[model samples]
Target: MAEKAPKEMSFLDHLEELRWLLVRSTIAILVLASLSFFISDFIFEKILFGPKDPNFITYRFFCSISQSFGLEDVEICDAKMPFIIQNTSMGGQVSFLIWTCITAGFIIGFPYILWEVWKFISPALYAKEKKYAGAFVIVSSLLFFLGVLFGYFIITPLSVYFFGSFNASPEIVNEFNLESYTSMIKTSTIACGLLFELPIIIYFLTKMGLVSASFLRKYRKYALVIVLIVAAIITPPDVISQIIVTIPIMALYEISILISAVVGKKELMESTSK
Candidate 1:
């Protein structure tokens, strides 16, 4: 049996389709957001403010690792951080609450969002491509959550530690604004989450003939430099922190290259058989 081409939908038809996708996605986000709002206290105190505390799980885990290696004076093992978070604006708290809910909505609703996106694109894909739909969603979701965890547990703590301890002079105090602190945490978490979609991105790009494994390999060094630059931008200026952040990103890039190769080979074999 011959496969049929996707129907040519009008501009308005496409718009209507997109509108429904958005509507469904929005509903999902709102439902999740409403639930999260009810538990906002726990989210704010335990998850959002976690990195700022000396007893945060990441800090304790690293502290234990350091102790095992006889590096007992590791900075993360400290009893307390020498900084404070405060709100300078009158509406800062209110704004923070609203934005936090929106962010939580997006994160919690990400799987549904992916489903909608896949639905919109699936009609254009080959039968073989459609077969991998479940795998695509599972792998992408896992990578995003892992990236979020990395950002929350690793990047956030390192940033807090560096910024909190930094003092140009004894007269200066490190009283960070609440808005700024939340913004840092949000950016780190969300940015890493998106960045971790590299493999999925490469897979699609390979399918579209927009990227290839050889090209990625050829530019590997340049990609490493770009990854390091990104790490430096998102993390503290310290070499150790930058290296820690860059390592996972570099690993993701290698994985992306492998995915691209697999996708490219599969597509090529299918075309040849046809």
Candidate 2:
């Protein structure tokens, strides 16, 4: 005998499920954040302030490339980061530590969060689709982490370098606040992480008949402009940094188009076979 279909859930049941999902996700984040306190010093000094140092890996890598190309005059080769980060408020340090740990926990617990989200939505999916839950969570988490790394290594350093080095007047000193610096890092990583989910999002949108490969292709030029705009918003107001950020995003958009095409084709085949 064939297996019976799952029973339909009531509106209240769905809400209850959603509530549990949030509860579980929050617990996971909190647990991970608590663990982060054990290594808070490393996070603050090595990871957060890494970009602020002139000898940071990103800066050194760029400096090497400049020297190889005989672009010694390029400012990227300069060994100066004329800025200091300070906390003005008495409670600022404590608040920053707590929030930063929370952000880190969110990033680390992303896979668990995705699993909870999958469980919440799995009831609505066909059995075949539900079986791919593991792959979904893994791929989504991988993409998110990759985006975070890209943001940290590429966007954050560029933003720090540009803002840290820029002096409107010779007498002005760049003393950045702790909150502002941390905010920039958080924004860059989280923004890129979400942006990197483009292909996954496009796949679902195409599957839902909300978007199409043709639509994406037709608006490719517009997408390019939008990508550039996002890059400009995220990176320093320089051609090079914006272009560096734009390249990956545009590539993701192209990949999203391809994903949409494949999903569209699969749906078309399924409909035709019916």
Candidate 3:
């Protein structure tokens, strides 16, 4: 038997559908977050504090890279990082656990959220368009995870190293608040994960006629500037670090342009055929 097509929905019905989707997504997040609570110890101790140690994998890799240049006294190979983490408030840890689980929930539940979002949007898309759902979820999830890894290994470590090693004077000691430290990690991971969705965003924008390949190409230089600025903001104050971070972002932009162009051409062809 053929599947029954979804009925055309009124505006209120659409809103109701969206509300349910959101409710479901939230439930999925909370469920995953609850699961995360059990593993909070591992998340807190190993992954969160790992970068603070000089012997962390990322630091060791960077030190290895630096040594290849025969730079013996490179900052990355330091004996110890120069900061300590502390909790300033009574509810600090309780607050941290709740927020951390929520963050993990969001990350882990991202695929389900995308599935819900696709269900909402699928009614509006053509049969052919609906077929890309799997691709959309997989590609987007992969991009987000890649961005998270990049932020953790490259951006987070670099930021940690820069701030941890920085001292105004010998008299001033850098003591990082637990909340502040976690915020940095969360921001770095989540922000980069979202940023890596640029190509996907452009694809949709192009479909909606809000952007085009020509426009993206024309503003390439401006986009490059913006990319460099974002790289500088996230990375430590160094040319090499900025370039290292900028490369993947620039590639994403290029991918966005390509995606936009493909989407544009497909739309144009469809209109011409009609």
RMSD (CA, Å), each prediction = 2.5, 2.4, 2.7
**Tens-digit lDDT string for candidate 3 (1-274):** 2233467889999999999999999999999999999999999988889889888887777667667767667766773688999999999999999999999999998888988988998888877778889999999999989989998888898888878887889999999999999999999999999989899899989999999999999999998999888777755554666787889989999999999999999989888877
TM-score of each: 0.89, 0.92, 0.93
- The global Cα lDDT (0 to 1) of model 1 is 0.83
lDDT of 2 by residue, 83-163 (tens): 889999999999999999999999999999989988888777776787799899999999999999998998899888878
Off by over 4 Å in 1: 1-6, 229-244
Candidate 2, residue 36: how far the Cα is off, in Å: 0.3
Candidate 3 segments whose C-alpha is farther than 4 A from its true place: 1-6, 233-238
Q: Model 3: clashing residue pairs?
A: none
Q: List clashing residue pairs in candidate 2.
A: none
lDDT of 1 by residue, 1-274 (tens): 2363467677888789899999999989888888888889998999889888888887787667667768766666774678999999999998888789889999978978998888877777766567778887888899999989888888888777777877899999889999999999999898889989989888888989999999999999998998788777655454555777788989999999999999899888878888
Ranking by lDDT: 3, 2, 1
At residue 134, give the lDDT of candidate 1: 84
Which 10-residue window of candidate 2 scores lowest in summed lDDT? 233-242
Better of 1 and 3 by TM-score: 3
